[model samples]
Target: MSTTEDLTKDLSRIMQLAASDPHDIGPLLNYGLDWMLRLAPFDLVAVFLLESDHLVVKAARGPLADARVLRHAISLDNFTSIREALATCGPRLFYEEDHAHGEGDPFDGVLDFPHGHACMVIPLCFGGNAQGIITFDRERCGTYDSQTIQLVEIYAQVLAMAIHQAAQSQLLHQLMRESNERERILREEHQAGDLLSPLQSKNPAVRELGERARQVAPTPTPVLIHGETGTGKEGIAAFIHQWSERRRQPMVKLNCAAIPESLLESELFGVVKGAFTGAVKDRPGRFRMANGGTLFLDEIGELPLPLQAKLLRVIQEGTFEPVGSDRTIKVDVRILAATNVNLQEAIGERRFREDLYYRLNVFPVQLPPLRQRLEDLGPLCDSLLGRLGRRLGKPPLLLSENTLARLRQYSWPGNIRELGNLLERAAILARGSVLTPNLFDLSHSSDVKAGVGESPTPSADASAEAPMISLDEAQKRHIRMVLNRVNGKVYGPGGAAEILGLKPSTLQSRMKKLGLERKVHFEA
Candidate 1:
């Protein structure tokens, strides 16, 4: 028989072990129950809980019950005293004299089993909710003393708290797992949607060019863009600026050809107040305004040779004196120059400075004309038409197969800018939802409609068959057809460039080259 001293010492040892590792709750619970049973001399202890539809064995000692215990009804009749004790908020004790088994005791004839026994049922409560019941039985012991029953009740309270904490932890883990999975799915969908956007380039050449531009955008190199006019040169320059280290700063643009040679110097290097007849207040030049940013000079080839020297000095040394001012201003700027004219040819003719050309040509990117990449027309047209429809506040429009086919065959000399303008005009003028062929007119056509027979044979029939229209007359008729198709709105929407498959800039240049301006007058 264990004395009280031994029980106290054993309890102290178990408490020390439990305190050593609070993290290992499973082992701590089982070890605690085992130590308590050895010291307190209990025959069996059963820990069961009604969870969902099954009665689960949570913790146990001795041959009390198997882990796969079946679920049982919990009515007042089956466990009268147990239910009564739960309502009374105390443990229930059945004395050996009062105990009775109603025809269901499997171990009745076993060595340590007895039909009549003493047992106590303690209700497990956590946060005011009844979780389960704990039972301790003794075959020979008459009944548990009050002190022993009180100790058993204290153990049940601690065990219930641990079980409740474990359940909450499991729920939190499940919620975190589900949240992580949802975030991963959202990221995947976002990436897939990005891949389907119109700006996602599939053309190898364009893709490579875009990648290269991105790589160079962070640098402060002087980028020289070579492409025909109306190819969105300024847009590319703006993109480079936006992606560069100086994105937060301003990007100043100067049209080298638009400002006259006499005023170009003052325009670039600002004049002091009252220095010139039109000068009212002191103003900053392009270079000064673009300090710590970018300066995009379009039509760089048109800069006069005299002003080129001053521009070159500023670009090379970052020091320039404003016109009519002796004070020199130093600026940190990224120079991006664009031109449609051949600079090398201009330099050979002494029209452009060779040294300045080399300075600006440090990083050159040649944009391919739209005619070279005809495959991108479909997506480009779709995007342009969608934007145009939105801007015009009209129903969505679709280009007919014949119209698209004709567009693909036409040489788009003006590139994307021309295409956008064409769509805008077509959206406004289109009578129905479809852009038909009659809304578009092709320029630079060969004489396919003219009869290709040999010279007329001498006869009345031959004279009647001979065409009276001369080549010049045919050329005038073609020009009129092109103009009529564009609705006479030149330079922007519904322009000659849309009909001629040329950029507006390109059309203007071609009109100059072909002397079309002499025959056709442009209304302001």
Candidate 2:
């Protein structure tokens, strides 16, 4: 085709493509470059944009220089000609090659393009602001025709419009993505935020544990969660998935011990239609359902020995066969296994596979019991109280000083989960705003009440009753009292940190400063 016809055809196509898929700039720029080469006598085309800290290669079509790596950034203050060109043209075309020694020019001393024989520069503009530049270079000598130059300028204007619209679309897309991410995070926080606090503990070990949990949330590494039964292992697993790359995907859960041994395989790996007498239809397994997401195997230690081998095979190969089916289906999933039972012991007993243990234990996060974080008790109470109060729709409840003091003296056999349950119950029963000593359920705090009743005795109670107690003695006594109430539990919902109205992390820090034991407990 002739130059005019070719330019006409290319420009038409660029406009069509931009109108059809206005969100994409790649297609529009590529079309422009193809025609700009054919209509003109240029062998190379490059597009560049000055980003915040560096220059970016927007588009390039040639075999000359390493244009990808030739992302040269010039300071706006230092390179005045380039800056002026941007300020003036902003999407205009320039044919100047040796602009360094030009009269009345801002660039007094600069290197001209010696290797680059001749150049045609086009500024990319949007909304009166210069966005970038598109340059076409030729190796041999030739002056562009007036008609050809006019045509190129017209095409450049169209190209600039396409670039601007594409950029606006991309900016909108990015804003939407960020907004979705923020909303998702806020929802997850609303769902799980009431369960833990950062200021509830001052112990280093507890703080370290919380930090580990936070750090592991964004990773796909298989997490092995270890803790007592009421320690909120499932909560940790959910936290990890909520903050991970696979947050949008499903979080499948199965209690290994809850399902019967005979049905466990079908439950985990799914079953084909008519596989067994009760099999009704082709079914997707938990692993398949949790594809591109997380699968939480609660009480992993209870998985039958025979099923353990199958589980191991699936974990290793990402493929599993349905019950009575030979065909293996593949899936992508992150495993999060929680067990109150000691996995090492289970492995020693030949109940759990060693290979599976290692696979799930890629990142092990152990939850501390409630008694360990006395400082967290207070905040945990506030959180739980708020939730329960909202659920019950009553006046805001307050945990009385005496009630909290009494709570600090008991050993919580059930960890954070237990504490949440206990507080929820207490909050419901509390007639007034205060959670008094009558609401306490544990047996360990009997002595705290007993000691409170006796008027005068020559025991620790006598010394504690004195009004002129030293600050050192008072702090130590206070610490001892809170520890006694919680029975030394720390690092979870409703632990000592919750009762104490502090973050488990903050309490942990204070404990380190005080040189407290790793296992902090309350003793009346």
Candidate 3:
């Protein structure tokens, strides 16, 4: 094909590709680089896209550089030819090695082509401003003729539009992420207020726990929030972060158990670009995101032993290297860890590092389970209802006297979360404003009154000598009663295991040891 025909054909395909997938131009750029090599006299061609004030090799053809070398970010301010070309670019940076016309060009000392006899530069423009540069270099001692230069310049224009399309897509996605992040922050701040409401109540223990949280909030000490699952551990963690000096910054969180063991380290620290197959871009992990704020690691006892050592180092030194990158990054993140599992038990099993446990336990705070502090139930229900009402667009939410009394009767194995979920359900179900006890299904709740799961004590004279059940019998009867209450369901939501605050697997294991089953309630 003629040179003009070739340029027309290549430019047509490039425009079609740009219009089709503007978000990613990798395939288009790579294919275009091949076409450029075919069209130009140069043996080498490279496309340097501007990113954060540096020109990075976006694509290349021939013996220009290796894959790693292609990513090298040469500063635009430092490269004279690139700077001048980009600034006055409808006029190209015409470099002839024999004459030194464009001296100290082509990334100067940084990225010089080994066989460069002469080179031509084309500044890429989008919206009247230069966004990148295209360099064509040849081994033979000869300058580009006018016709070849003009054809190549046409190709450069086509390439520039593709680069701009990719950049715009990236910018649009980034703006959307930022907008969603703002909305999430606002939602959290409101939830934090609700979480703090129980701490402000007349209950002495709840008030004291809040006071301890307030005392520790100002310090940079690492806080360990010890509590059962659904006991508002996350809420207390958020409360501490909100009352701290770094409240204005982000409070990023991660649940250790929720992520797989292999991927947890990268999530906590970070991953460098090309670190693994999927790691195409650098991810600044929770530690970096929570810099100058707090990183709350929920279910912390599930953290594996190997990562614990690295975590200990970060806690002590405030520095960690991202996965696959040797460079150390430092951050001033306040660490807050929560766990339903006993770390001491984990330490005894040799599953957790001893040193990491001590480092994270500097300011330990325990959240009392809801059943233990029944006095706060009224206040908790009120706060949850008001929030749920506004969120669900309901008229109003009210807990009937009978419902509150029944709430106090049940042993809330699920704690505050269960209460909130229960209230939300009630509000959804109710035709009127009043939420009755029937909204809390009998199968999901227990008959254990007063304190949760505590057996009633007999007066000294009445039952001192009465025949007492054996410990095994007592356990068997209790398990049977809970199982019967839930109608033998063990694993799904509203199961007996959940009401008993035990993992279904663990519950099954215990049943095997005690020789119990779904239907059998052992007794005479």
Give me the candidate number with maximum lDDT.
3
* TM-scores for the candidates: 0.46, 0.50, 0.61
Give RMSD (Å) of candidate 3 vs. truth.
Answer: 11.6
- Put down candidate 2 lDDT per residue, 91-149, tens digits, no spaces: 22333444333322121222234432555666666566777777666655444566766
User: All models: lDDT?
Assistant: 0.65, 0.67, 0.74
Summarize candidate 3's per-residue lDDT along 1-524 as a digit string, tens digits: 79778777877887777666545677878877887766776666888877657887878787755665575568766666567778876645344552363344554555554433667778888678798888877667667888777877777787787777766765566456545654576567666676544358677977898989989998999999998889998888888888899888778889999999888989999886678998876667778767777888998898888889899998889899999877888999899999988888899999888889899998898887775576677888888898898889998788866566556665677888988888888899877888865566645333543222223432223223223334344445556667776778888899977766667997888777778976665332
Candidate 1's C-alpha runs over 4 A off are 1-199, 386-401, 431-434, 443-524
Model 2, CA-based lDDT: 0.67
Say which prediction, candidate 1 or candidate 2, comes out ahead on TM-score: 2
Report how far residue 257 has shifted in candidate 3, in Å.
1.3
Q: How big is the positional error of residue 426 in model 1, measured in Å on the Cα after superposition?
A: 1.4
Query: What range of 10 consecutive residues in model 3 has the weakest lDDT sum?
Result: 457-466
Judge candidate 1 against the unseen true structure and give its global Cα lDDT, from 0 to 1. 0.65
Question: Using TM-score as the measure, which candidate wins?
Answer: 3
